[model samples]
Target: MQFQHPELLYALFLLLIPIFIHLFQLRRFKQVDFTNVAFLKKVTIQTRKSSQLKKWITLLLRLLALACIIIAFAQPFTATKTALNTEKETVLYLDNSYSMQAKGSNGPLLNRSLQDLYNVQLPSEKISWFTNDVTRKNTSLEDFKSELLSVSPSQGQLALSEVLLKANQLFSNAEASDKRLILISDFQQNEAFPEIPDEVTVNAVQLQPVNTNNITIDTAYIASKNGNNMQLKVAVSGSGDVPASVPVSLYKGKTLLAKTAVDLSSEKKNTTVFDIETSGNLKGKLELTDPNLAYDNSLFFSINAPKKIKVLSINEVNSGFLQRLFGQEEFAYTQQTQSNLNYNEIPNQDFIVINGLKDIPASLAVALQSFSKQGGSVLVIPSEKANLSDYNNLLATLGMGRFTEKVSAEKQITQIVFDHPLYENVFEKRVVNFQYPTVNSYYQTNTNATDVLRYEDGNPFIFQKNNTYFLSAPINLENSNFQNSPLIVPTFYNMAQQSLAVPHLYYTIGQQNKFDIAVQLMEDEILKIKDSSSTFIPLQQTKANKVTVTTIEEPATAGTFEIVKDADFIASISYNYNRSESNLQYMDIENWEGANSSASISALFDTIMEANNINSFWKWFVIFALLFLLLELLVLKFFK
Candidate 1:
């Protein structure tokens, strides 16, 4: 029992005034009323005695009425230990991973799970939903239905830890009557489970889908060891009690390269080895030939074409450093002694490194400028032996602007642009040790220069403009002490590959896009992705800061997409996927841990009522007040 408002008990103090008045009160009557004198004295004394008794009773009734009024104001309520009227809003967290496509009694595991949701007699009380892949909080039944309808089984695997983190965050601010979390998953026993938060009560729902007679090809790789040209082995395993033969196919783009079938048994795993000759655009898909196992039918994979990059280094013939660095087979390098070489006759090459070209010839400058503008890259390492004025003017023409007189290199520099693409992941930590071997004199650019490395005096040492890059030091191995440094290999490779050549696009199968293709950062302002008509669509990244575009078209198909940035193309992306959307089965509740757990939904309501004890306590006091009013009436009528 609790009082909703204990303060109302103060009304009992009013009863003291009534009692005092009744005890010490006096009344005056006319003398004629007792005219019977001596003869009527005895009879009058009896009546007076009755009148006094009635007065006392009336006063008592009035006091009781006052007490009742106070009690009523203090509103009393009962607190039941168990649920008297149990009603709960159970939040269902369903895991809709690709593995959920396993078959079950209710059809595919995922579909069965959804049907089970509809089966639960969730009261008129609203329901909230969540998914392992998506966040759903404070969601109504309709919203849940909508999300479920739109949910396609995802390809990316989610860690249990990440799922729990999202679930906790979603329910953090919920004000539901009684919150319950019901997780439905296959519960792949090998995976680690995350710790549940104390505030939330977790109920794990176990999936018992039909066991698959599956033989999946885990992976296939190619290798040639010690002049032995042999195809590598590919592993295959059964996902269930039964196993059968699975067919594998190798392809170059859409062309079939090879095909074979391997038998798999339930008792043991099997591996299939094959050898093939291929050139460009190779991909593979493995499929189970068994008819019963349709959900895990085919798995797709891609392998990149072998790369052959060539470089043309033009400089004086006596440059021993250039000769040594270019000796490696990793690059196909061609050396030209003439600085006036024509680029038109130059063969197809990935990069062009120009050395000792003090004043670039007018024709060569035009060719290099056009090449860079057309998405090719060039690294220009200047020399102290040539004309600085002509090169400085050339720098202005390339949009890098005029250069000031060169400054001597120091042992260490300040504010190295570690965040730049060339250096972002090149080093585990900051490179604190760097010695400048050649203090080559040169003019510094005043405008349009992206200073990659800066000295303590704030002078730019390494900078880039347009597609052309300018290194303050000679890249030739013998000319500088850079090759002796441990950071030389990775640094040079990363700069040439990443900083110079723009990346193709980034695409993740089965994951939603991070950035919308239409959106751009223009003129220092955030802009939305819009069509030519200026209609906007929301753009967001899936996980990385890189943009992901969610095309309304069939995203399961393979295709390439280009991203335009700052009038420069940074990366090219390709979408290659075949997302499966077959199964819809649910988990079994009987086998789940804490399945028989009992909890009263009304306990929370009791807690709220207890906090409002003052109000409830007054209600009981009020009922007493009403009873007192009735007693006062009886005393006045019947006693009179």
Candidate 2:
């Protein structure tokens, strides 16, 4: 026990006044004669004893009253481990991440946290408030409460290490002798706590949810597409040991496309495939019937509509096979010799095939480099009698390796990199002992590029670097049989198909914020993204022909959105909630031992007050002092 104001204890000397009065009153007594001797003697004995007892009682009451008053002014209290000091600071970290939306005893865990804050008895110290996305310092208790009313579950997730580091920085320059951090969170297992410093003490309050069994649509992607029919694969995951069977639905704007039941009994993670007929832009969602944790139950996705590809063949010696391969109904193919090539049409083409160009012009090399840098793909087919220096100059300008020399030895294409994106979903099964393309003579180049097709002698037959693809041998009638080979169709078709910018199927909220659009907006036109509920203009920056837009304020809900320019639909975008908050596991209380933590807010406040060492017992002491004085008054009034 200790006194907050010990100087007031000196007032205990006032008790001497009451003692002196009692001693002085004893001397004022005088002797008296009795009328009857026998009666007077008996009465004197009884009256003397009663008078002495009353005086002792009265004196003790007065002394007790005086002592209680002095002790009340001294303000005594019990001390804790930390000694009380003048200045103190408190930092409160309230987690508002999406994981706090889980149900608790009262309502949502976030609501329970708010109720706990309302019942907290704040000390007379500077208070700092921290949330996942917002931070305010030196706020009053009332102000903090008012701000908390407007806070909701946020998509941004803050790890425990980040919160601790911020708290340490906030208290680093504090002049207070005792600094404390109060953390209120669901303590999700996805977030790990870091080692805390001993200079500042931490008081953690973990809020546990009622239900931990949660099933969510982890992710969805296109498995395969054949003509108009596409096989969409969706991965589902859960948290607890309990098995569950949930219904999964796919929707396209208000129309239900398909519905199926998924059995999550044995596997924690299961991938289900759905076949659907799609036309134009495919915008939809994969939803599961789980209301407990609804944030991750639905995933939004969009697949862009197919567009016609424009292919331009710049040839010095025209090859009939090149035109027949690219001049299909889906492609707008045009061929021109190098002397008759128009530089003005370069930007409009998706792919440019330089076929057997003996000499590449300086101006054409610059245009090709600019075209490749702006997301255009280039396919180079070198001539057998090509000028090595001219080809090397063009290759050097385009950041590709130069052809060293021509080899006379014949080689066959024996290896193909089937795992490359260019060959993704191209074959149903691997073909073994198949016929290979043979080249009588080819260029022997030392290029550090991804070898998509290797020769029989381990030399590169076809290599790619960024948007540039190099074929070692030309498709001349006397030189090679690559044009007639089965690999010729997909190799050229996929090259032109991949040149156009394809919108991503879906983006995870808080992870992807930037997107590139292939649209070339006019001077007066501005791009805007909108959903059914809200619309906003994003931060746009133009690079070459493409425009990159970054979301300024991300949407609160996940769904498919449309990007429009002047009321014309440019493309579709989809967003889904981050899966980090779907896991409901948390840290146990036993793991948090010795961390100065409490499950109840009131108990934590009591501990902090004890640590302050200034618990005000003065009010209770004053009540006792007044009661004692009342007792003394009763004794003096009635006993006399």
N/CA/C clash count, model 2: 0
Model 1 stretches astray by more than 4 angstroms: 1-91, 103-108, 132-151, 168-180, 187-199, 208-215, 220-247, 251-257, 260-274, 277-284, 288-297, 301-310, 317-338, 343-349, 356-375, 379-640
Using lDDT as the measure, the top candidate is 2
Per-residue C-alpha lDDT of model 1 across residues 1-640, encoded as one tens digit per residue: 6565778778778778877887777875445445668867777678788988898888878877777666667666665432232444456667777677676666777777776555444433455666644666666767676577776565544555666666656554644444456667775443444556655556565666666444454545554422223475666666455445667675544567667777765444677776755443334554445444353455454333333345667775355555565555445667775546656544344467777676666666676666665445577777655466766666766788666665444333344687776677577887666664333243454656887766456666567875577766444444445445544455455544532222222244565544222223434433233222322333433211223345433244344433345445433345444332222223333444433221221332243344333323554566677878888887788775
lDDT, residue 622, model 2: 85
In candidate 2, what are the lDDT values of residues 109-158, reduced to their tens digit?
88888877777778654588789878988888888878878888888777
* Worst 10 contiguous positions by lDDT, candidate 1: 596-605
In candidate 2, position 489 carries an lDDT of: 90
